[model samples]
Every structure is written in C-alpha cells, then in structure tokens.
Target: MPLCLDPNGNRCSYWPQDAHFVWEKNGQKIETCVSEQTHVLADGRVHVLTWIKDAVVQDSQYCCLVSSKAGNKMSTSYISVEGSNNQDSWSRGFASWKSIISEHDKLMTNWKKTWESCNKKDIV
Candidate 1:
C-alpha cells in the first residue's frame, strides 16, 4: 500500500507502498491507504491533510520542537544607527524592512535545502 494525498481536501487513508514516499507541499493533496483520515503533522510541522493519526495527536509538542529547531537554525543581525539628522535616520528606518525580507528569504532557502536532503530516497 502506498500513501496518497487527497486531491479534493477530504480525509483519506495511507499505507506505505515501499520504503519511500512523495513530498507534497502546502495546499497540495496526497493519496494514501490508511483507513482513518486525520490531520497530519510531519517532522513537527503541521500539514493540512495528514494521514498519520499520531502526527495529528502529537502536533503541539512537535510544533514546539520544530519551532525550537527553526530558531536555532536562524541567525539575526540587527544594526542600530543614530543619525545626526532626521532625514538620515528616516531613510535607514525605511530600508530596514528590505533587510528583514532578505533574511527571511535566506532562511527559507536553507530550510528547503535541508528538507530535500532529508527526504531523498530511491523508489523501486
């Protein structure tokens, strides 16, 4: 049996077809063979439609663990500059959001790479 994502946003069952499974992103569906349909939490992350009942049951603890791991992997650098003139300070403040966004993008890229590496498997 193989686990599949539900395409229609409904509950479904999943069975392990082999030693490997597919990686589905958010807003995507997977089909599986498990009889009970429940929300799935994977790797301490909450998934919208997960077939693993245990994943749903342990979501809270898993979520905390995941958050801690994410926090550990993130690096933040903040620089505060006091300008002699108001205009200079205003300009620096306005540009701060861009730096924040760039940092977020870096974190996202790193997380994606980590996920891909962990989920790599050969299907027979």
Candidate 2:
C-alpha cells in the first residue's frame, strides 16, 4: 500500500507478487490462493485467506482472513502483514508516509467494490 512520486524518476510502488495463502476453519486448513473458492467449515461457515506483498524488502508477507456463517448478517475479518528492515537506516526512493496514506484510500475503494460484489447476492 505504498506509493511514491519522484522528480528523479526513481519512484517505487508496492504490489503483491508470487503470493500464496491458506484458510483455516474448524481445525481444518485449505488453500485459497488464486482459486476464488471459499473454505467451508464444519459449522457451515465459509472462510477465505488472501495474501499480498508487504513491501520492497525481501521476505515480507501479508495475509487476511474473512469468515461468514449462513443466515448471519455479519462476518469477521482480520489482516496482518509482517516484514523486517533496519530501523536506523534510511532508504532513498522509498514512498513517503503521506503517499502511503493516499494509496491506502485508493486501495480501500477497490476493496469496497469487491466486497459489495461478493455480498451482493446474500440473503438478508
């Protein structure tokens, strides 16, 4: 969710690459990467996990989970991303915090559209 602008043409952006994720339900785990299929739990709940690239640094990962039950009007979701970098050092051409905030808004808009579409046919 980082964005950058540079006058020196060195701008860099964060994007998911070669991602994989798994979903857990009722003590069972299932793969859900690029398949678009939800994992069904023993209690008839649907769960999914998604992964995205965390940052430019190597060995970074981001994951999210969403769960829903039949006849339930609400669902639970969680997200987490992790990475390690030298805190004291500075990296040039990195996106500023402000740029990241702006990019987050844009990402949220896209996510909202996907969420609406996913729940569009659900029974209220």
Candidate 2 has what TM-score?
0.22
What lDDT is obtained when candidate 1 is compared to the true structure?
0.40
Worst 10 residues of 2 by lDDT: 11-20
Candidate 1 residue-pair clash tally: 17
Local error of candidate 2 at residue 100 (angstroms): 0.3
Which window of 10 residues has the lowest lDDT sum in candidate 1? 57-66
Alpha-carbon TM-score of each model against the true structure: 0.26, 0.22
Off by over 4 Å in 2: 1-95
Which lDDT tens digits does candidate 1 get at residues 88-119?
A: 66678779978999999999999988878777
- Against the true structure, candidate 1 reaches a TM-score of 0.26
